[model samples]
Target chain A: MGEFPTVTDVARVAGVSRQTVSNVMNTPGIVKADTRARVEAAISALGYRPHASARRLRTRRSSTIGIRLDPMIDGISGSVLDRFLHALTEQADARGLRVLLFTATSPEDEISQFRRLNDGADVDGFVLTSTTADDPRTEWLLEQGIAFVTFGRPWRSDDFTAPRHPWVDVDGYSGLHAATRAQQDAGATRIAYIGWPSPSGTGDDRRRGWHDAMLERGDVSAEDLACLEVVTADGVDQGAAAMQQLARTAGGIDAVLCASDALALGAMIANPARVPVTGYDNTPIAAAIGLSSVDQPVDEVAAAALELLAGEFEGKSGAPSDPAPPPFRMVTPRLITRQFAAIPRDSVPVNALVSEVSR
Target chain B: MGEFPTVTDVARVAGVSRQTVSNVMNTPGIVKADTRARVEAAISALGYRPHASARRLRTRRSSTIGIRLDPMIDGISGSVLDRFLHALTEQADARGLRVLLFTATSPEDEISQFRRLNDGADVDGFVLTSTTADDPRTEWLLEQGIAFVTFGRPWRSDDFTAPRHPWVDVDGYSGLHAATRAQQDAGATRIAYIGWPSPSGTGDDRRRGWHDAMLERGDVSAEDLACLEVVTADGVDQGAAAMQQLARTAGGIDAVLCASDALALGAMIANPARVPVTGYDNTPIAAAIGLSSVDQPVDEVAAAALELLAGEFEGKSGAPSDPAPPPFRMVTPRLITRQFAAIPRDSVPVNALVSEVSR
Candidate 1:
């Protein structure tokens, strides 16, 4: 690469003094329009992009926040991530906070990467997504004394006694309830619940909501319902197998509620075309297929995350919680249904059709 | 966030001097295992993530790279972005460089974002994705003398003239020609090409390749074997509509080639159960469904992008390129055929389909 144009070069190209270039940058309106245009043209012509972090260090305020994602989570559907990323982008834009993206190949890499960025002063604070039950990142952030907030809920005891970190999560329990209610409203009495492992906080809540909704209806009992724990690799094929297994059980299930759209897609490929399914995370694919799903307010989650991060940055430590806890704040999920789950009563029943989930 | 424990705090908690904590951080092996464990426990308890940027600035050798994605470009699916991102993550991990993500909401915002990061010493160089015709961001980088590389062909005449700016792009024409020949080899005489807008360099090349291949095979007259352009949107519905329009005019073509898996998906959904179609960009769905596609070596693209950026940073200015026109390096695309495109000639007569297209 050739030598980058220095400020003097910009002045030369713009045919203006260096002071004028500075004025055009920091106080553009103050400069004459013609002069401003010239400077801008020169800037564009020269490919003059400024270095942000160095300027931030000098100014002591970057207005940029660093975000970390787990590589394992990257393999998930693009549509779901698009929603979350969109939300984050919209909120960050409004707040004038730039996002710094970092990916950790493994859990251990998390600490080293965080250290690199933190020491560099490349960001003001941190925003973390997709945390596991026993998260080390949270604990590490707490020790570093960095101002940070997470997308998922934290598992800590005696909240006040533990290091306080703010977080915002979708109310998965309520979302599941809404999904089940939508299916039941569509005339589904024998409903089946397909969920993820309990280690995932949101997944656990969804499973609970499904059972609670079913019990409240009193149309089906624990023995009548089937729960499928989905594994990660080959999710679609495994989902198809689980659907077939659920169908073989004594009274056939009418509607199925899936924890994720990926699982829902799998179930759709797995289920007999006649058997309808419900899904959570109204991902783009779910919309494309017209699958009924619970649409968690991704925009709301992103807004709340930014607000929490801003609050922490503003020196507002953990907020007051209900009497049962020291720190507390929660957001709820919304339900959205489409053609797939809105089956008519006159439609052929599962047993009358293929009598099994198609592999 | 509370006050983070300094080196002193770790030392105090571990019953050692402050230098001991510092030593434990720099060289864990130097410290006794028990002492190191105590320091580690203290570090974990205190959340002590190191700030690498701060040290790097002082050392003048920070291992970080800047990334700028326009929200518009990033939002587009089937654009080779997912593969690029994945490649960036893997290569960056191997090279020990962290990515600092930033968004340029508009062309004007590009300058400030670049200056803010670069001047602050946030990164050593940058990888730019999805530049439009006559891009201002590219121009500004050229003027400022920053180090950067793009993933697509540049619109400006003087782009390659700028020593510090470089680019790497897919060899679309070759890939499209290969797909066309593959279709011919499958015993299909009536082949139709469905592609996106030709303003995209890749799309233009693919279109050209299709024309050339059809000419060589004499499958259809020059006027009959024309390439149809389709607009990109949310789902395959639009793709289905476009394909239906082409199918109606072309007397139900036998084999079709698509620009992306998303488009191919739309085509599949349009017919639902039967259709012989091939797509470019072997995305995950292509593999899952076993649809034939051209796989642009994403890992190679990202590695090349990084290498281009590194060259610029090292002041080499121009990346290696073909001396001939087109002014950019072209990486070849590999063909991957799956079950969807594996239709046997016996299933559908080639002469009949050709007669339909000729009409």
Candidate 2:
């Protein structure tokens, strides 16, 4: 936080030549103990600290943490992983660290990359994202005693297995819970949920948020099970089709909440009758289209993750000696309400929409 | 290309043990000249290349390239930059090189960061994005004899300077030229262009695309100049507002084109009639809403940039002895058509849209 202690400062305080200070700092064993002691005392008295980079040099570490960029990008509109990488790099820089970006075809291949990079001393640790059920990479990293933190909730193929690694995730359950409760407060009676099919912890947790909120309202109906819940693949098309199906089957759905902005965007596009719609992940598209959505504090999540993985968790957790899981962080999410506009019209044919309309 | 030639293969061809081949390769001068010549002959005979990493270590280069991530991100819905980064990482990995991600507060600050990282031998070269007029960083890089290639066309602020470095940019001029011609082909005589106000090469290049196509149609009128071109600051709101302005000034505008999907999305949102709208950077939002956009083959740009910067350009163009600017590549762009549908009404109130109603 203050000016870095220079060799000149040390020499001035210790009444020694700058070379002696440099010798004491870089090769302390070569210096006479008393002279080295005097220089060290002067450094402490002046409240001067050496450069962090120099301290890391003594450890023979690269002072760089590696992050793997998945070869496949899911949605261009929701580059949550990219945003996390951005924040992590900035936070790492502030700590005199750098980010090493690598790519791997799969989780197993990622383990190999970790081995290769570590063997070459190219990276000291890693940051993981989009962890899935029974993640093989987690297992491999744990076996190798590699240092890392996941930006997703840990899943072990079963709920009984407690997480064994450090992780930081957006609290989607609470985010959607509040979103649904807000709709209720705003006089929505029959709320429907549109989300991905289950078995994924993230999807299930978000759907639970809506279910619990509707239950709290005592507006839960048996029809909610068969008629309301629409579980489909992820995308605006799936979401729109799901909403259309829900409208055809069940009559009185008033408010809709989606697991993603993609779903909400789709729902908004196909909304036959005007309906209040909310989406998760307040992506730029959601904002552009004026859809209420949950905003994950991506920067905070990255900072917390770097602090836990690269700063503190490295020394304490995810170590082979301690086979227990590290404490996890659940970053709170916020809601942005812009209220989607109704586009109440049948879609025109793609070809006819753009034609020789005389100028 | 071929199976990486092993020491065994070289030794077998040289009629020597693998250990002798290894020693000859590592410490050739220490080995007898006759034996070294034999090993060298065998290496050539087998098309054997020494480990690139070991060669890099001997040269004291990190075999890593730097890419600067601006502290602020523009849009989540169309992270063209993020996509470009993803492709670059994959391509770099293929070349036994890694990418170092850094952040900077300004273009000038990026120059300092480049110096800092390079001084540490952490990176051997750089890939610059978003190059703008009178880019101080580019000037600094050239003056310092740093190795780099930009992913954007260079500009000297005066508009007379040819880009003075190796670069790979999508042919936005051609992409938009074709897009405007498509509209012209479709019978829309009066077309409007919405883009950023500029001395920027990208903005200017795209504007020229539209202007040129319109010129091909006939002599462009003064009224056409005033009403058909709208340039403003970036954002959906600004774009929406700009399109509204154009609509008010010029009637019978049948088609619109934008420099970015954000602007096109805005223009679509505020559409007073069913006008064919197009956007650039075929982002996910463009696909979701079916907005026709120009697709910049990002993967191709990344590959071409790395090919020029890290591959051939490194050895041939950026040598300290030769200070001339390297060659640049312009990958062709493609147009994707997905006509946007008309919403057909003013937005309903957020509350009114949520109220319970009988079907």
Candidate 3:
């Protein structure tokens, strides 16, 4: 019930005028350095709070970026998304920016929300993830001339009108190839692929890698591997059902490669303790379960996406004649081998000493 | 690429005056119902976008609520947080409000960020989670006369100075009681409790429930139980080590109770075929693993919190007083059981089949 200390309190504490205290907060560089320091110290002491809503009203800009998430994938737990968002959040904070969140059930709904934001002038920019190759929303964003960066590349290159659209993509094909080759190295003649293949650019790339790797092996025929084509947005259920079906029907498959850690976790749980499951996206769940998987550099992807969007926001589109295409920034995933079969037996400690790296 | 549509286009299409079109978009009640319908039809046809920001600037209200999260917990995957946030976001959208996110690394940093927002004139109100006992920031908010609703009750009653200060919390202690009692029903007397004890009121509450349930059980004594307190913020490794220690030292513990699904997953993976583990929160991982746990009603909590906050913001104090002394709202939780235990022959089929009501 105590009255809050005002600007006058800080002014009296610092032995400066109220105008000087205001300058320290609003235009610190304009004030003498020593005086500004004293003013700041006094302000800290009094716990003075400035009215931000009124200031934003005066400035006519909210230094906040609105992020819209597709709801279908919202069911996919945060274990996969935490690292990427955390990196983005930390970096955004460092740049004196904040994030606004919008959620939509479908592509059309997301576009409507985006359009509303554009009309509202509520945010300065946007960051999008899990984009499809032929996504209609991307075209709409381009039409509105909104600055955006996506985590995954769109499947259709022809839909892009903004020659300098920025995106951060994982080398999905390369990661799958490495996983398949690793299985082959471990004396496996045929490997089963459990994944959801769609017009999704990443999924297609992974399928291509599996196909190419099998072809390179020569001994394994296309018919030998099981490809689960039905991909549900509710990936956990889909993965569980897919694994259960595979377990009931498949024969002699030594290793399984999954497109996501969620699917891999489901596959592992449903494996009846017989088969080895490998997954992409080294999420915390995979680490906890001791499933060997490819670690997509989520931190790197988030950083690159921000840098690209920041560049566009800063008006450095890279060219006037023909803007240089934003590089298809592909982060190579590292193979993170844990308690599964990758490590040598000698390295397996007899004691149950838990590793400190928790996700 | 095309010029944006204007009021003239809408008027021309609708066969109405330009003013009528404006009224249809902004103030529909002024226009005749038929005329309003015509104008709306025309606007949709032309893909007309209204200038939302200009109107907000004119009105001096953005209709946005600021949300601040603890950075350590913020890193706890968007997927886990999404359920609660999605609920809040949807509730806000239903009332035509937006959420602006402000991330802060610590409590001290959050105070400064809050000050910045207040001075910057950005947000109308705040929705804060992680309000610990003796929260200094909550006290500061009251001192500044800002509108805020904490997700939980602050520890110190004196901190609840603002007449309009409101809070919404999950019934953690009661849910924990249910979970413990359920384990006891399943013939688990020597139950091991695993989790951290800290600012997370939920963790502490669950511990209290476990303590009370054990004390109430005449068959179980204090010496028969085990408590694995994970001091590290890094949960998975801490959980694994803690579980390993409990598994080694706790001679007669029949079951394990976890503060989070993350810990349960770790324990399950580490022991595989040994102990029966139950988790709180019933996160997606818990579902995938079929761990019997308590399910927090995040949606209900979010809706209740928003309703209470909105009531306070509308100049209504003593609004949430429920004719009870505690002045607290509690959301009911459900017990989710899966394949964590060996069901009796008669119980196996019913439990194995997903409940018809659930379906």
Candidate 4:
């Protein structure tokens, strides 16, 4: 084998610490520009390259993360899972880890894959996504004592205070709270929410955000809340139908917020009354059509997820009483304001609806 | 360790060969239904599970295929690469091979990754995508005598008939030919094509298909061909610009075809000529907006690519002097006719341009 420059050599040439050199190569875009420039120059001058397998053998870690792809297609229009995979792979590359991709027809099938990949010692750990309430995979992995960090939060049907597995979830609640405030500030009095069917942790979180924001505003009536909140399956057709049903109500909704961009886009299309609509997951369609939506920090989610997963191997969060909350990383999502759909002047006001309509 | 049922147990229970049982597990969708049913019943009857690591120890194989994920995002509006990855992962799962994804910034960086992965005995083979002429990766893998199958055909710069590495490619030529025929059948004569600037194997194949089809139709003169065949960069704006330029030409093109759906979508938006446009890679936007497009058979491509890669390990085709050419497997793409955009008959044809302008 030809002689290759090492971390020490690169560090020496660049006049930087060994860790800095590692960081520069592993996470390319995040390094300081000047430090990156110096490290890159040193790398080019020395023609340095890190030997991954040698490092793997020395660490006794395969340096691979296992992920399962769903065999059946879901209704995610913008390929968010794909983007997440893209980001995860990039982050894994930066960290000198290989991503092992497999497919599962169901959650049980996924558990089978996890066992196989683990038994083979092919992967150091696994990264879980799209976690749901009473997740069987999480329960199984925990029982087997496998090292993993999920991209989504565990439902944890038991005590919420108990320390558990590491996880990173996008804060959909905060995004919706901000959206509700934005709607309030936009002269929308009779605001309505179209969320996915209940019992979903994500859906409930988003609904609570709206509820909390509305309570803080102190203007919404309890009767108004009961009239406006609706649940439906995720689809453009479903969103449109929900909105039409809301429109036929006595007071008539002045504005709408959806859990997804698909719903928002549909609402806008169905709106003859020009009700302002906002959606979550600022998808490509939302950006293309100028619909207001929320953008989840997928990049940050991947980074934090990797960091938490690595923490397991590093023994940073081994004991339940460690007090750091098991790196229960919660990433903040931001509101993306685009074509703000404004409510028309002639729209019936919620307060005056009974009188005006009765007359 | 508890003794678990293996492929032999399943085979014995199913009254079939072990290979048939393996096939039923891997490539589940492709196996004959009756065989699959029998193997499935056997699997359940015997409670048999293929122990991946045990099988690996026996075969001296890792049961993994390495793939490089590109960090830079492309102009594919709907994340076609992500969909391709999804399909590939599913297909690989069916074939009992896991896909290991890594990212490299350049060819040299990629070579470094390949070497590290190889030295570690991390994977059984490699799958290459987007092969270019004189591809450095291909050359290196070939020199090292690594078992690999590329999803793209190598640009044949040398002797066209020489024994080369195995590959699977979507037949862009046939897809374009079908598109041209579809347009011609829709009562269009002056068909103009907008393709990516070439020497790209894919671009060349698609352009040649259109060129040959136009010739077979025998309707286009050399001068007409010159005006019709336009080359530009890959983008919607570029397509709009190219179509606009084609519009200013003397004959006034009646039908348009694009190398990508992004370009076709752009042409539809910038349709001053009211030409019906057909696109390749029927993305989500195309399906939603009812744009006619060519759907590349991603599933078939993944299946064939896996089969060819496995063939190398199985010694299906061996030696340079062997009479049979490498399968060079080509999957066919089908033309998807959606809400077909038809030109308005009352709109001024190219022949009426002078009179309309004068008036």
Candidate 5:
């Protein structure tokens, strides 16, 4: 193997001391312009690159962000994470940071990886996704005094005024609320909702959006509301079954809103009433099928996560940190309305009512 | 921040010299069993982890694999890369290797990233994906004498008996051939194919599979072959348009096979004749919509790539290597047959002809 060019070689070629070369590479602003240019030219000519590990050892920072690549399960919804990861990688690259990917089978396994990475000082911080209520990962990271940010809120309590760590999450409730109101504005008298079973933080939040919208109408009684809402497991087939049950129980359904695109698709397929349906996550399939869906601003979420991490690292760099509120961003999602095309509308009676609604 | 435990602290706790501690960490087999256990216990108690950067510098090897995370376009087909990444991460982790992701806008940009990563010795090797004919990235890596494996063939020539570098690619020709034969077995007298425009190595290779199968049938004339083949850009809408064009130009397309699920879905939606359709890539949407498609064994591709890289690295470590042929694995893809359900079959006459054939 050929030997790689060293800093000494670059310094000799540039007619400068080794320290000047180091200054040119690490703190170019501190070096004279002419000397820095000369050093850079020599570096380019010799194809010299400073060892990342050696530099990291000196700075006590890896300039790398770590994230877990969860196993691919639901390809429909899993594309959300894929998009976010791409955005994060692009944003991190712009900020001179790299993303290191690791895999863990369980939360416990993830924590062990965190410890291993933390002990080695292999990464500056971590960006976590797929947060659940009272997430053990967050708790462990906080206790370890690790610098990290999550793409989801802690969901520990109803009051989201403060969190123990930094986080950024999309507002599912607001998204569904907008979807329901849009359906109401479209001259739909009866709108049914299909969602995941209770105890899910995200699902419950979205369901409340539809519930509140229905209550504001003042025409539907509590008994009617109960009849209009269907809670089932999150899947395409489960969604189809829920729609069937809703059609049998809830009279004359004019519209349906789902917690996810998977369920929304199922509802569209099984819709005998041919109601206009809205889904969450605005997935590729939703776009292909022309389903009106809620779109999470994943790029904004990634940017916010990085911003919080930057603030944390800046505070650790001996800056005079303010007694600020725990950092958090509740990004409102946008409703992407497309022409409903899952079923042929000419054969259904409700099509006349929904046709005039601007999509 | 609290001070992290160092080799000195571990050595003191284990009642050993710093050199002994280092030896224990680096080469446990060289240390006495009792001494190794004592050092390990001390490390566990102190929560000491050997510095990854320091170890890397000593060994001149970073146990990290670099890959460019291309921007997410065509979410339907893009899921293939997502799945491959997850599988690679899992397999690399099992081998004590890390996967580092970077974004590149073009081949030139990707090559620059390779240089940057290589200069720092930050990654041991790279795994290239999304190969095109005469890919400059592979050329640059080869010129630099870097250890790398590609998840795609070089595609520089028609004769793929040997290549410049180790690679593992799915056999697109076989996949399409099997898909065509499956349709024939299902009583499809006239089968049509929809694929991307030519000059795309992967696309053309897949097209050939269908072409060879039809040619072997002896029943399809050259003029009929031209009529049955539709070439266009890859998109759902494009697929739909292609299928329409086929229905107009080609008579009675009893079954259709697409180069991608996105195209197959389009053909299915636009099929007024209600023919069974198959897509490639066996994406989650295919399963959701019950579109039979070809499935790539990404897990196997990842394993093969890593195994090739290991062989390359082993050859570099003063081991006598065999004069073996350049490593390559043309993995055969599986034709996943699912019940076609994009359109209802009760009204279509073609359904009667296809119903007797097993799925």
Candidate 6:
């Protein structure tokens, strides 16, 4: 036949009804083994491929996940999302699911997209990224009883034990704490912290890591700790400027810990020979320049997000209706330390040694 | 009323047949204006959503584009695809299309995925990346008469004027040519060219740019031009090694031009103060380290690929059956010039100046 084969064609070829043909394709367990075998043979012989949309409409389930593809803001840190997306796609594909991408300008637009995709039955669930404080997207999703898992914590409250929705986040506090401790172990007495301004959940969490690490040292007084901390906007230039100021006022900073690779890079640029700097996110720039940084296990985060979405929290406490704490995974990060003769300034020397430790 | 509103419910509410309701939803242009308006109102009042799969099955168009999400191999150059995917998602969204992502182990697996998506009526077309010589994917797509566009040229032939399929690619030759000219104009007479090994389409094209630029200068002999060039596998370490070998063997290298930012960065790291280098792709590393490089206009490429897939080549002299050179777009890249006191090799001091120019 010149026309494409349809369900009816498969039914006639298999000597079965149209519903039987569909049942063989969608709900094979409901059909008898002999009849299913005949239908399968007919489907293969005639190359009768069932339309995904038609099957989805009948079953009211599309093996597809929806996600909002954010614009590339900065290649440095923006690469985290890129890596996460790649990992998510691979994981979803392994589960025989497709990842559908849409673009939205804002949280409201994203929620609207969710409604469109959910209403159209185009997606079974969603994976959200870049979670912010009191994220309206999560609020809307929770209100709608939609299935979704974020790659970041809800950040609605400081208590990580409780959240309204499932989430997977990198433990920034642990990452920075380890970085600070690593520097301290390397014999750095006065280490300076450069990070984004307060009222930011991620930045503050990372800053606290450095703060607690210094406090545990017992040698640096609380006043000295306060002086060692420098707040600035996140950027290489801002990091450089912060390092410069801290060096002048903090009385010779032996090491520097940053909230982001951009800031760490700046600090390294400002004083290549004076201090060993560690940055967060372990971006490519850090590896290229031989700067130590905290590496977020995004692949683990992706896997955990998929598990949460798959409702793999059966062994955990609380029922579906109970006010139980939603399942969330906090993946520990690894600190990558590189000891080079100097930070990449106008080339002066050589010798590079790299090491990694998970916290 | 408690259950989802289907065609039967919508038809009953609107006082129309089920087919009429479908026509209103799927082919509104064919329905009477008054009847279509009435059905739409009933749909809105009842919150009746026409299932996307049902409509797709009826119309045989899903308005979806399939793209394979490559695993993130290296954050540096891999970011180009990341940026392209983001732009493509945004551009496709602006046209009321969705992007579906899948992962495959190899080209054969990718083709099977294409068949699955195409036969299942889950996608209208595809957007392929990483085009290679005699790509079997393109061959299969051509044989299947699929509507798809590649982001790179069909390298089956060097004469880009005639390709079996439509494509959008950056003019790497022009990008390197402009970069070479820029370095020469900056008063650098003895420039060294660093690139990947030959038999590679993109690498060869870029090398020709530098080669032709040197030939045009009329000062460097053919023998000297050959001596000035060094080829190696693409990487930062490889680049540094190549640069060192070139510097020692070629004698007194004033400037360096690399096929990629990774190589350029490597060269800069090896000789921070000795050579000013330019790299291709203008990765974030280039900016962080203050290295000059060429920037691909990926946004334009995304738009052009979508246009080609949408059949925007109506003005071109090619009938459906005619072999009148399937339309293609070769976008010219821009050169970003960044001058700093030194590379980040245990930095001593810096005075940075950044500028950009289109070629």
Q: State which candidate has the highest TM-score.
A: 5
Deviation in Å, model 1, residue B252 alpha carbon: 2.6
- Candidate 5 lDDT tens digits, B145-181: 5779999898876426658788989999999999898
Q: Please provide, for model 5 over A1-359, each residue's C-alpha lDDT reduced to its tens digit, 9 standing for 90 to 100.
A: 11345789889999999999977654555788678778867866665656665456556678889999978878887778888999999999999899999999999899999988876677888999988887889888866556799998888764376577888999999898888888888887688899988888889899999889888876577788888889988788777888889878888688999999989878877775567888899888787767778999899998999999998787654432346656889899999877554563222122221122110
Q: What is the interface RMSD of each candidate, in Å?
A: 15.3, 14.6, 16.8, 19.1, 15.3, 14.6
State the displacement of the C-alpha of residue A66, model 5, in Å, after optimal TM-score superposition.
0.7
Best by lDDT: 5
Error of 2 at B38 (Å): 43
Give the alpha carbon lDDT tens digit for every residue of A202-290 in model 4: 88999888888877887778777877887888766567678877887726876889988767756665676877788888665454334
Tell me the tens digit of each residue's lDDT in model 3 across B1-359.
11345678779999988877866554444678678677767765664545554344334346778887445342222244556666788878878788877678778888888777756546667888866776778877766646678777665543234323577777677777777887788898777788675756667777788778888985666656534333434355455566767767776567777887766655554563356777777665555445667776778888887877676565422232233322345677776765443211221121112121100
Using alpha carbons, what is the TM-score of model 5?
A: 0.83
- Go through the candidates in order and give the C-alpha RMSD of each one to the true structure: 10.6, 12.5, 11.9, 15.4, 10.6, 10.4
For model 6, residues A1-359, the per-residue Cα lDDT tens digits are 11346788889989999999977655565788789889877876665556654455444457888999987777777777787888899998998889999999999999999988876777878999988888999887776556789988888764476777888899999999888888788798788899888888889889999999999997699988888989998777787789878867987778889999988877776775557788888788777777778888888998898889877223211132446667889999988766533454433211111111111
Q: Could you give candidate 1's per-residue lDDT for residues A1-359 as a string of tens digits?
A: 11234567778999999999877655554788789889877865664544543344334355778776444332324445545665786578678787776777665687777776666566678888776667888777766656688877785553334435777777888888877787788798877777765566677788889889998998876655544333343254555556666767535777777887666666666565347776777654455445667776777888888887787766622321223321335678777655443322222122222121110
Residues B91-174, candidate 2: write the lDDT tens digits.
999988899998888777888898787556577789999988777887877765567888887765422245577778888889
Error of 6 at A320 (Å): 7.6
Winning model by DockQ: 6
> Candidate 4: which stretches are off by over 4 Å?
A1-59, A72-75, A157-163, A218-220, A272-274, A316-324, A340-359, B1-58, B72-78, B157-160, B243-251, B272-274, B316-324, B340-359
Quote the true-contact fraction of every model.
0.16, 0.26, 0.22, 0.20, 0.34, 0.37
lDDT string, candidate 2, A154-230, tens digits: 86542334667778888889988998888888898788999888788889989999888887788767656457789
Can you give the lDDT of residue A207 in candidate 4? 86
Can you give the TM-score per candidate against the true fold? 0.76, 0.79, 0.74, 0.76, 0.83, 0.83
Q: Least lDDT summed over 10 consecutive residues: which range in candidate 2 chain B?
A: B350-359
What DockQ do the predictions score, one after another?
0.12, 0.14, 0.13, 0.10, 0.18, 0.20
Q: List the residue pairs that clash in candidate 2.
A: none
Q: Is candidate 1 or candidate 3 better by DockQ?
A: 3
The clash count of every prediction, one per candidate, is 48, 0, 20, 4, 0, 9
Give the residue spans of candidate 5 off by over 4 A: A1-49, A319-322, A344-359, B1-50, B319-322, B342-359
